[model samples]
Target: MKLKHILIGVGVLLALILVLKFTGVIGGEKTEKVTVEAAGNKKVVETVTASGKIQPETEVKLSSEVSGEVTELLVKEGDVVKKGQLLCKVRPDILQSGYERAVASYNSQKATVASTQQQLIQNQANFANASATYKRNVELYNKKVISASEFDAAKAAYLTAQANLASAKENVTGAKFGLEQSGANVKEAGANLARTTIYSPVDGVVSKLSIELGDRILGTSQMAGTEIMRISNLSSMEVNVDVNENDINRVNVGDSATIEVDAFADKKFKGIVTEIASSSTSVGTASTSVDQVTNFSVKVRILADSYSSVKGGAKDLPSPFRPGLSATVDIESESLTSLAVPIQAIFTGDKEKSPSQAATATNDQSQDKQKAKLNDKNIKQYVYLFDSKASTVKKAEVTTGIQDDQYIIVKTGLKAGQEIVSGPYSAIQNKLKDGLKVEKTTKDKLFSADGKN
Candidate 1:
């Protein structure tokens, strides 16, 4: 009986060893499970995304030049109008009165000029009579036919008439100058009065109306006046977006774009980059803060043919997109096919020696640095490559280029068809060490208890 008990004990011990090996606790199966992807050629397009408002390609802001109440508002917001069409009118009480005063002044000056001309004509006749009388008096004095008193009296009257004629001519010249001054005033007052009547400068819809009937407004001539309304060419639409300064270098005019408007959630509009601002600011407004994020303004014009479905049916209906609808734009700067890997597979490795450093580590300092990678605190970007022969992951330093939504282009240090740890971010980021034993597995299996590939 003692011998049989010993044999049963040995069998139980053997079963325990087999269980340990199966669970990967004390065998070669001990390894971290990680998801891997084979690097391959992929089509990649670099893009820069930005958010902004949809604006008309052509828009004109209307403002009054004369301050007054908006007495006559001919069109409301969203009303379509034509060039030179009457849009609104300001109260013309003060302006009309001034214009009338200028007209009266001009007419009065004209009458004064005419009266002075008549006086000048009479003075000319008087001057002619004075000269003839003076000649006759001289002849009479020479012949002694008349007394000295008569001759002197005639000469004095002739001198007085000559002075009066010269004065009359001077009065006519002064009156003509006054007429010219009054004419200038009339023109200026007329121009100011015309400004009270607003007209559409272009054919468009009134996208914005800032004034109601009888609302008082300041004129632009005096200050930054109230904007009466905005006329927009709705058929021609564009988005004015602010892109990050970091990404603005990748954007250029004539680049294709995909625009997503907040209002049209279901549709994506096609666009082309039309303009790029040379100067950068803090988004819409200028800011002087050192921490402020800089952004460049870019304009993307939505193609007319692409949005025909959303166009208004009749002249009375407004356009589909107003002047300030929110929109997001993705400008595609470039596209190419290159060897790429999932971005998730890459992570910053702590204190690891770079590939170049390790390759040419003949110097003492370089060798020391390579040896201290395990304990050094310096960090650099790296990816884990799967070695099929050893069933392990090797840390590799990689050079990367531009990336899109999913994959990043591997510029160097990687080849096509090579397996790379793609996921189980926790393992790729922290758990996997250089030459660490690893097993291929699905992303979901990385979290399983057994960790089997």
Candidate 2:
């Protein structure tokens, strides 16, 4: 009786286990699967990716023409100023004093000229009087009515007067020349003084101001000094990017580009390839110091119409885009009217595989197996098409064209309207066959393989 009870208990436990397995309380195999259909459509696109910043193409920097202490800053940074507007003023006191001294000297020279003219007239009058006396004396002597000594004395007096007149005329000429020299000095001093007041060179906003009140500015000379300010046209902008030697050939004038600034997160502006540097402009650095690596600068111009759209009006972008703000850009080098798929879809057979594990098979057999493995479908890029009537997958060979990271253009051997398997490749690898019958499984049946109902 005890043995029979034990046997009955074992049978009951087995029965319960079977029941649990059937109810999905235990693991089991999945019978059905779910599938997605592939649809073909034309995707028109022109896209590329680059990085750059928005900037004023004609950024006018306001710098001092002459060195002086900064006496007054007329405008602060971000002040919208017009062309020829006074933005700042260097200390003009010294310049003014110099100019005044120059004027005084000029006046003094003018007075000297007048005095010289008066002296020249007086000298001429005295010479004339002496000549008249000499003439009278000569007449008296010639008529024998006066002594020879008196005539001689009159002649000596006339000669002395003539010498004095010549000397006076020379002094007058020297004084006049001195006056002209003083006048020129005055004009030069005035020009230097005018240079002290800094002015806006263009119709732009004051983007920068390097001086506060009392900042000494070293004028233009061998040792260039600090700048007063920078003015830029807020409306106009440009981007400069360095193109690699490999890509420089593709980049040309008049190509299209897109720009995005980090400051303005939601904005995208259109630009054009306006200028490409003819000569290479690359400064070598430590990392790039390795011989033979080189790059060239390329400048792009922003289209006004596109900028307006990006700003969402004409006023959003800050005047003279702040330098050092990060930006991204994309230049369209080429485009084609063709069908494309994700680059991940195309797999190359060139990828190397890890060594296989030890098997029941020997070295010679393993070598043979490895040789056969070369012909495996792991490498060749293939697309599986769904045969609607047969309900099976068909392999299609393909040729490919240009690929940007996201998508690749299909060159040939794949037609539109044909559904291709995009996933579950491993599961269907051997079980799937051409003209084989199939039906998509429901969600419940699909997860059944993992023991979930």
Candidate 3:
């Protein structure tokens, strides 16, 4: 009976040990190891992305100041023109008549001024003669050579002549002023008449022609027809983009940027920030409301010209880009020269497995400044280092610095040319540890896993 009890106890002990071994609680088992090496420094560029449109930097809209019928159109949509070049002409009959009438009016005023000046000169001469006679009569009256009434009459005559001379001088001055005003009116009319022949105000390409020959163009006014044609300097262009309110604070003038046009997908252009709006507002089309957008406008100067042509060995653009082409732009705000890692490497939770159990571990230094890690903290980061003896993996906690959307700088705990575990975290989590053995997949295996050759 005692021997039998002892045998049963031994059997139970063996069974318990077998269960523990199967559950991996008391014995080691072979695991696919993750080999790792140290990672070196990498250059990281932080950028902000935005959608924008290409536009001409300078656009001039030519319009008629004087109303007239268009008799001829000298330029087309793609024609390049110089400043003050004849663009189009209108019927000159009415303008010519008005100009002639203005000239005649000015000449009449001039004649009137001349006649008034001659009358003023005659009045002055008469006043001088009357004064001399008055002086002679006064002397004679004092000497009793003439009567007192005669001397008084001569003095009155001299005073009347002086008043006449003053009136004539004032008339001459008024006539001269009238003549000058008439001349100015004539010049203004002449200028308006000349304006009927439309001229290019800037050196640019003819972007638009609103009217053809025989179409009457109305005068430029606030309520009436204003635009007749448009000319733009297309040698250099600009990109205007509205950045969201959330990202506006991160943008500034003179930041380096890149632009890609939808029309020209193969080419990428460079630009620089030139202006930033001080205010914010919501903008959208009729189909989309997009309320609470609160976007601010930013203007970028493109470094590449749309046309790369030369005239007489001098580098110049053939034509500037059109005003309304869509573009995708990336503004580089910051860059670092030290170590960088993918943003995915920084994890905020160890929900799958606890950090303590993992062979290759990530020390969470972000928890307590003094302690290497705290179990309660959620934020976690991992990097694998080479395990030389066992040909396996080890992990460490790394402090992080500035980051963009794609990459982040590793402030501490990383070096260059070391292989770190980049993927397959779930498969290797339980078996990870310092100095554990590991095996790495080849590039062909990784590619083939995705069903790619």
Which of the two, 1 or 3, has more lDDT?
A: 1
Cα lDDT of model 3 by residue, 1-453, tens digit: 999999999999999999989986679565553423246677887777788887778888777777878888888777889998998888888879989999999999999999999999999999999989998998899899998788889999999999999999999999999999999989988997888787888998776777888888788545546588888887778899988776788888999998887876677778899988887644344453646467888888888542343122112334335668898889887888787765544443353465454424432322122122211234566666655556677677877765665556777777766566654443334445666666676545654663652
lDDT of 3 at 336: 88
**2 or 3, which is superior by lDDT?**
3
Estimate, for each residue in 279-379, the C-alpha lDDT of model 2 and write its tens digit: 66555344444565566777777677765544333253453256556677788777776676544334334322322333234535543443343224454
- The numbered model that scores best in lDDT is 1
How high is the CA lDDT of each candidate model? 0.82, 0.67, 0.72
Q: Would you give me the overall lDDT of model 3?
A: 0.72
Clash number for each model: 0, 4, 12
Descending-TM-score candidate ranking: 1, 3, 2
Question: Ten-residue segment with the worst summed lDDT in candidate 2?
Answer: 350-359
TM-score comparison, 1 vs 3, better candidate? 1
How do the residues 370-437 of candidate 1 rate in per-residue lDDT, one tens digit apiece? 22332222445578889988888888888776666677788888999999988665456456788888
**What is the clash count of model 2?**
4
Residue pairs in clash, model 2 = 33-441, 50-329, 51-329, 67-219
Q: C-alpha displacement of 314 in model 2, angstroms?
A: 11
